[model samples]
Target: MGYIAFTIGFIVFFFVLAFLSTTFSIPADAMLPIGGLLLLVMIIAIAAYAALS
Candidate 1:
């Protein structure tokens, strides 16, 4: 249940970033780094969960 929630939250975060970037004319480069970092963090969290569980 926690994993599911984390996954959903991670996805929503990126989608919101993308939407905001498009709506606000944010530079692709700036958005890419932020999105990438979020994705990286999510991946690490999931991997840690898998390894420890």
Candidate 2:
């Protein structure tokens, strides 16, 4: 169970990192807000999944 969770989180972390790197060309200042919003969305998604399960 721990391994599964770790693997999923690892994949998601890298996926998001790659996406942000490739998709955004803005400055770090601009990216700060975007990253925060994406993090919030990710948290919400995880919370929703937990609630549904």
lDDT of each: 0.81, 0.69
Q: Worst 10-residue stretch by lDDT in candidate 2?
A: 1-10
lDDT of 1 by residue, 1-53 (tens): 66785778787887889798989989988888878887887788777877777
* Candidate 1 lDDT (Cα, 0 to 1): 0.81
Off by over 4 Å in 2: 1-14
Model 2, range 1-53, lDDT digits (tens) per residue?
44555458657866886687678756778767777777777667666666666
Residue 33, candidate 2: C-alpha displacement in angstroms? 0.4
Indicate the residue-level lDDT of 7 in model 1.
73
Residue 37 of model 2 has an lDDT of 79
Among all candidates shown, the one with the greatest lDDT? 1
